[model samples]
Target: MENILIPLMDNELSPRFDLAPEVLIISITRETSAMGTLSERVINFETPSAEAMYRLVMAENIQTIICAGMEKEVYEFLKRKGIKVLDNVCGPVDPILEAYLAGHLSSGQNYF
Candidate 1:
């Protein structure tokens, strides 16, 4: 399975309480040794539109999305397209994803 993990600026990854300026979209390919790879770098150019973000994810062939927060419309669209969405995950991406794969991450309160 391939999954994307984004690190937020607060809650664990950093002391600041704001989403990272740039969203890091990672593609994790589960294989013999759990290969973690970076597919692309998505830079939100002054509040990018939901459609643009969605398109970027599609272009990178991401199956799952992990982020701090997302608009409801975008989330719904991704869900309809068969993409799993995980929200309220604030911390360093790699460790958070590792926790998720190990079944230690849980869906927290909804913020969108």
Candidate 2:
């Protein structure tokens, strides 16, 4: 079982991390092959802080993050907590999640 988080801009991925106005979360299980939606939340920030986002990820028990252009400090912090951050992923939210479910999502790449 794993929970994945994406910083979203409309239905597409945000162009950059730490600047997304909203977020989408998915809950997935290896045995069941379903992309279950856990929640979607607005990032409450005039300027979204990486630290604030990290706290939300931790609180949500997010195992993986599919996002674009994350800062090194934030990336390292998530890794230190054993969370997988797939940075630089670009495209529509649905296809990206689908690619992940099919096991081919990657950082700095488009897998659709």
Candidate 3:
């Protein structure tokens, strides 16, 4: 199973990563050519903070992050931690997650 995190603003991907108020964490399992969701949960922050987000990511053991935009430092931090960062993705949460499961999502792709 792979643990993925997506920063959210309302129902869509947050335009700015550090400013996102909520984050969705999902666990998916891939078998053969099929993918299935194992679990999903949302974490709401009292205030947006990159440090807090990073702590959650570490605590949750997130393997991948699907987000719209993030600072260079934050991106580098995740990379250094061996986490996959799919930046610049824009779309509603459902479609974006579906596309990712299908292996069709890419950075800088706008689905909105």
Candidate 4:
């Protein structure tokens, strides 16, 4: 299974990374043909810095993260950790997640 995390704000993608407090955590099997059997949970935390968020993700063994914006340095830091960080994604969280599971989400997508 691949663990995914999406920073959220009132059910939409958070306007910015640092501002996101509640993150929707999802676990989907590696076979990403469709929305696989998903198990989801919520984790509320401040700061999106690689230093802090890194620990949380590591703890959960997260494989991917879909978020709005992030510092280039932090992005690189996570990438180096072997975690896929999809940045510059904007839209309501549900549609975003659906599109992602459907295998079409990419950086700089604005489904607003």
Candidate 5:
């Protein structure tokens, strides 16, 4: 099973699903690895550093993460730990992520 952690901003939702900042929604499935789907959503407390982020993933056992941006320190930390970081994403996360899951979006080489 593959797990995806997505960091989201508050305004992305149009009042219906108001969420807090520095929170991540996790998605997963039994088949096809639905990392960003709505089946599962896990909210985090803070935006951790690279090393701390790796530790969080280890604690949660997550494999991937989707976010708008990240610090270089965190990037290298996750890379060394073999955790895939998908950064530089735009708002209204659900759509962008859906596209990614559908094979339309690429994480790009900037993260590596």
Candidate 6:
């Protein structure tokens, strides 16, 4: 099982990681099929804060993060903590999540 987090803005991938208003977390079991067995959760932030997001990532045990843009420092921080950060991803959240589950998503991928 893998826990993935995606920051969101208006139903699409956020333009910048630290500025996102909300996030979607999906816990996926890859043992099933391409779609896998997914359990999802959405978290809305009262205020956008990188610290808050980082705390949530740790608390939720997030294994991967799919984001549009991220600062180098933040990227390095997550990497050092053993998290996979797929940066520069663009498009609607649903399709992006589907591509990830289907094993076709990667950093710098754009659907729009």
lDDT of 3: 0.91
Count of clashes in candidate 1: 0
Model 5: lDDT of residue 42: 49
Candidate 4, residues 1-112, lDDT tens digits: the string is 8899888888988867656778889998755554357889988876554555667788999899899988788788789999998899998988899888888999999988
lDDT of 5 at 96: 64
Candidate 6 per-residue lDDT over residues 1-112, each given as its tens digit = 8999999999999998888999999998877464467899889999998999999999999999999999999999999999999999999998998888777899999999
Best by lDDT: 6
TM-score, model 1 to reference = 0.63
lDDT of 4: 0.83
CA-lDDT, candidates in order? 0.57, 0.78, 0.91, 0.83, 0.57, 0.92
The digit string of per-residue lDDT tens for model 3 on 2-107 reads: 9999999998999988889999999887665664646899999998898899899999999999999999999998999999999999989998988888789989
Query: Least accurate stretch of 10 residues (summed lDDT) in model 5?
Result: 11-20
TM-score of each: 0.63, 0.81, 0.93, 0.86, 0.67, 0.93
Residue 15 in model 5: lDDT? 15
The lDDT ranking, best first, is 6, 3, 4, 2, 1, 5
Tens digits of per-residue lDDT, candidate 2, 1-112, equal 6778889887888877778877887776555455443444444456666766777898889998999888888788889999988998888988887787778888878744
Model 3 ranges with Cα > 4 A deviation: 31-35
Residue 97 Cα positional deviation in candidate 1, in Å, after optimal superposition: 2.3
Model 6 TM-score on a 0 to 1 scale: 0.93
TM-score of 2: 0.81
Error of 3 at 20 (Å): 0.8
The clash numbers for all candidates, in the given order, read 0, 0, 0, 0, 1, 0
Q: RMSD, each candidate, Å?
A: 5.2, 2.9, 1.3, 2.3, 6.6, 1.4
Model 4 vs truth, CA RMSD: 2.3
